[model samples]
Target chain A: QVRNELALANAQELINKINEKCFSKCITKPGNKLDSSEQTCVAKCMDRYMEAWNIVSRAYISRVQRESQGESL
Target chain B: KELGKFLESENARMRLQQSIHTFTDLCWDKCINKISNKIDRGEETCLTNCVERFLDTSLFIVKRLEETRKKL
Candidate 1:
């Protein structure tokens, strides 16, 4: 029960971040409808953002492991 | 016993995810100027370095603060 809620919150946060970041990157001019080019840009931006997130997560984890080992020694 | 381990792991996962969100927000602006079909090697490297240097800056500040405290 509790776990599900936590997972939902995490996903919700990611969605919000993606929307805010991609919107600015894609939608230079707000229109009544999103043109094809803007839509394509949004998709690419979202993919790149996810890639950036993974790269950051890996770097952070490795740094943390190294710091912990240094502290113990 | 099992429940305690599960909760502990979940707590760590949550913290890890939160940090990723923050780094993505900061690094997106720094590394990404134009949207492209793929993240090129340069941009990927920039994202990784951004994370490392940010952590380094954090540790540096803390150590500097401790030294100042000792002097005072």
Candidate 2:
């Protein structure tokens, strides 16, 4: 219930961040269409962003566990 | 209660979101230079290492701060 809503909100935030970051990086010119090159750039940027997200999540989780272990010791 | 669990999960989600934003900024600065539409092996490795080292730096700062606080 509440958790689902929170997850949705977080996802929305990420989407907004992606739009801001990738749009700036990929779309130098707003052509009639997204243009093939621009579309490809956006696609790749999204993929790389996801990869970065996972890497950060893993690093953060392990650091947290280590810190908690130290607290108990 | 169910409400307590929901709140716990919500906190976790928020934390995850915050970290994602921070890392996106950090790694985006390092790994992404232009719209190449393809991440090379070197950039991918840099992104991974950027995240790991950022966390390490954060932990190191916290530990240093704690020590400083103890001295004060």
Candidate 3:
């Protein structure tokens, strides 16, 4: 239970960082409020970000696998 | 409060998601040319390639630097 709680806390910290970075990228200028178009952009940006993350994670994992295989040979 | 612990856990998940989100945005900008509602086949490939190549590049650079140091 303590371990799970610790993991959750760590994950939350990561989210805050991502939000700051993504928001800056998606929102060029801060308007009075988030307009519909801006909101749409943010939504799309979030999805794209997730896709990119998966791709990178997969790539990294595969590269690690390949390196390990090479070492075994 | 119990809610405090729940909030903390939720925050952690958000953080992990956000890290991935940033990485995707950075790589997508570098590798993707066209932006649409869904990632097309070509763009998807580009993204994967980009990630692999980026990692390779980092590793290569590090190795090269180490070799240079050894030669010194």
The per-model lDDT (C-alpha) reads 0.90, 0.78, 0.69
TM-score of 2: 0.76
Instruction: Point out the worst 10-residue segment of candidate 2 chain A by lDDT.
Output: A51-60
DockQ of 2: 0.51
Candidate 3: where are CA atoms >4 Å away? A1-10, B1-25, B32-35
Where model 1 places Cα greater than 4 Å from the true spot, the runs are B1-5
Model 2 CA deviation exceeding 4 Å by range: A70-73, B34-38, B69-72
Candidate 1 structure quality by residue, lDDT tens digits, B1-72: 999999999898888889989998999899999888888999999999999999889989999999999999
User: Which candidate achieves the best lDDT against the true structure?
Assistant: 1
For candidate 1, give the lDDT.
Answer: 0.90
- Which residue pairs collide, candidate 2? none
Two-way TM-score contest, 2 vs 3, winner = 2
Question: Cα deviation in Å at residue B10, candidate 1?
Answer: 2.2
lDDT (tens digit, per residue) of candidate 2 on B1-72: 998887887787788678877887778788778655456778777876887788788879999999999999
Task: Give the Cα error of residue A49 in candidate 3, in Å.
Answer: 0.9
Every candidate's TM-score, chain A alone: 0.90, 0.93, 0.76
True lDDT of residue B1, candidate 1? 100
